[model samples]
Target: MAEPFWLVRPRHDGGSDYVRFLPSQEAVEVREGSHLPPQMPLLKRRQWLPLKEAEDCRRHLQQEGGFRSSEPLF
Candidate 1:
């Protein structure tokens, strides 16, 4: 199984960005904001990056970007 599943960047205003490392795809997938009230569709952004760059993003998100890492969304 893949390790260190996801990284989540949350905002003070109650919105969040969810990120996933897709090694096979050689990119990162970012889910912008939450799906609140079950009405608004979640927006997705993909970045084509190298493995090292993706890992760097994970590090930045966890340490400097104020993101919650690999935590349950419940």
Candidate 2:
């Protein structure tokens, strides 16, 4: 069986709903009558990227062009 079955709970205005993940089966289940909250965002699979990849992307961006959005950009 796959490990680390996560349950995504959407937090909204005043309530929350749950969405479960079955990693072993690669399935996702949305509960009934569970309305999506406005405050909570819908997370995509791409959003759950590895830290190494994120760091690599950051490094690449830094190399391409350092943070220039600020007045005293580095």
How many clashes in each candidate? 0, 0
Candidate 1 lDDT: 0.59
**Root-mean-square deviation of each candidate, in angstroms?**
3.5, 14.1
lDDT by residue (tens digit), candidate 2, 1-74 = 13332232334455433322223233323222233445444434333334444444434544563321112100
Q: Candidate 2: worst 10 consecutive residues by lDDT?
A: 65-74
What are the per-residue Cα lDDT tens digits for candidate 1 across 15-57?
5567666565545544334533334636566665666777777
Question: Which one wins on lDDT?
Answer: 1
Model 2: how far residue 24 lies from native, Å: 22
TM-score of each: 0.60, 0.26
Superposed Cα deviation of residue 30, candidate 2 (Å): 25
The regions of model 2 sitting more than 4 angstroms off are: 1-46, 68-74
